[model samples]
Target: MATFIIEGGHQLKGSIQPQGAKNEALQILCAVLLTPETVTIHNIPDIIDVNKLISLLEKLGVKIHKIGSGSYTFKADEVNMKYLESPEFKEDGKGLRGSIMIVGPLLARFGKGYIPKPGGDKIGRRRLDTHFEGFINLGAKFRYNREDHFYGVEADRLKGAYMLLDEASVTGTANIVMAAVLAEGTTTIYNAACEPYLQQLCKMLNRMGAKISGVGSNMLRIEGVDSLGGTDHKMLPDMIEIGSWIGLAAMTKSELTIKNVSWDDLGQIPDVFRKLGITIERKGEDIYIPAHKEGYEIQSYIDGSILTVADAPWPGFTPDLLSIVLVIATQARGAVLVHQKMFESRLFFVDKLIDMGAKIILCDPHRATVIGHDFKSSLKATTMTSPDIRAGVSLLIAALSAKGSSTIHNIEQIDRGYERIDERLRAIGAKITRVN
Candidate 1:
């Protein structure tokens, strides 16, 4: 129950550093269950989701030490419990979507895992078919109660096998990889979601002694080991948040320097944003965004005049940022279509933007056409509530660029990606304040 009240129409100055990827942090935390040794994770974001996952781990008998600021040492040397199906554990676990990833790991290491229906954002239908299907492939038995919405899992020493996931799910891949690392034999996963988050999971596992090949590809091979050892790993920067900041800087005409961004891992984001006429400069590992950037119009291909940014499995524009990009396109010099094919109902938030006087055509559940308004901060400000992570950030950008002061409630949605966003924006001269 916190709200951000913002006074808009300010050319922001100064610099901001992106937080550690929350998505990656959750997966790495779940990987700790794979070993009985101490695993030190650095650059952990102090977001609610990470805190929830850490709370879950502590409940399961993991010993967590506060080594330093933004770092922790987690030792789950004695995993006293494998089943969590009560109302308390259910309420806590249901608060975040990333908890579902524990299913595969718990089944691989412990023989059984009890998970209730996991919840996160209210974007659309969050499916777990790929996750449960992968676990089934690895010899785990699963049962779901429709009335109770409880999903239970059980497996005995998961045997290695090949699984061709129906879709490239990021968490699904992480879950399967965590399970296969300790299985009896080799496991080959094809059409896997190879996002940087999953890459960090694999790297952390390998550091703990799991033999994993093809770190950033659709195909992954994991050679099951007897046990994983203790290791230290630092999570990568939040590329989605970085992209959001880049969009914010361009729209609001701000100059910013984002520190500790893993440039090597941001494979297609720069080029993709460049297609929309935003230029980014990399000074070593940090990214510099200039002021009043002339964000370009969408470029069309040789085949057609329409340019579309769609979400694929990975190595494509992330589905998580489609809403943000759509919002950014509202101020660009041209019209671009964003197709969120992965989730059918993700485009529902566009109506709120349309209400804010932006031009948008909701073609269907999967497609939307956004026409840039080139709107200067107007004199009118409105009250808005966040829907999901990407839309929430996009709305925050809108509020920051709007004419007057506005209020955005339920900002915890935005906090999932952007760490201490109000504070970070304040550093860059954004007039934002968080209030109870």
Candidate 2:
């Protein structure tokens, strides 16, 4: 396993650019299977999860060409349909959770799709019921192989229908939208996930000849088209990475500029950090975070109650960045309550932070109360293992702000999301090294 040895207490400088959105890239890459024409995608992040999905598509006979550093052209002119049922595919498909998305486009265009039980972060139970149920609502037959832990959906022809999702799952909404775009009639999806990335997917599909409306709302209407054509699409900069950088700057007292962040799309992220008493300045499209030399403070509610930072659907704070927020709060001026509503196991990483001398109370599996050390006490470095991608990056941030050198094992989890993180941190005066 790869590890990161970080020299702590160093302040980072200069500017860092966020990579293409990993979540969006997964959906966009799967959409390429909807058309036989070349779909040129720009700003594709070179990360493990996204790359795994691309390789999975390539193995399924999608022709992929590298056009530039972060650009690729994909054409699914001759997809190997039988490959989906092969042993090699079952192994590959189970490696990443994003591989589940390919089933939608495949089932849409070819009338059938199959996937092994998808694997991803063990943060919590992420059920696939939303995806399969949506497909079933669209006139697809669903079957599961309990022995093999496999799922399959097939239909001779899909007929659109109205669906009110039990939950506004981002991937689930994306999958259903992809399937409905090629159905026989109009499809209406209420309670859809309206995150910016999902909106990007809808817009891209529109460019590819799929009729979709309500691009940025919870209700999505899609008028099915006979076929979709290929088009060029560019991915938005990863908002989660941008939030991480913000938290990193505050934790290490660094003056850093995060370049080319699409500010308009970063809903509630800046405000939530500001409530933690971090200074975030907008310089056109870039986010300039000044050094919190005196340490930041947490704000209380108007009624003078303790502040609570919780994750909800979009237009609210993202759950992915809660780990970062929790880590940064360790050195802030006051206390804050972080409630992770979506995932049960995400807060389990607080024990590692507590080992480093941070004042945190693991209230339960869903909540934690972080009392800021206020920089009067620096965290003592220690060796640890990464639990998941978000938690791994959070640990890396904690190590960077600690008093001595720290070692993090199983850094492959971090690499799955961030692109060349060590190299990028090194450029910004961070003393981070990747050890094999």
lDDT tens per residue, model 2, 1-436: 9999999999999999999999999999999999999999999999999999999999999999998999999999999999998999999999999999999999999999999999999999999999999999999999999999999999988999999999999999999999999999999999999999999999999999999999899999999999999999999999999999999999999999999999999999999999999999999999999988999999999999999999999977899999999999999988999999999999999999999999999999999999999999999999999999999999999999998999999999999999999999999999988899
Question: What is the lDDT, from 0 to 100, of the residue 267 in candidate 2?
Answer: 95
Error of 1 at 141 (Å): 1.8
> Which candidate achieves the best lDDT against the true structure?
2
lDDT of 1: 0.84
User: How would you encode candidate 1's per-residue C-alpha lDDT over 158-261 as one tens digit per residue?
Assistant: 88999898888899899889989999899999999998889888888887899999999999999998888999999888888888888888778788888878
Q: What C-alpha lDDT values do all the predictions have?
A: 0.84, 0.96
Off by over 4 Å in 2: none
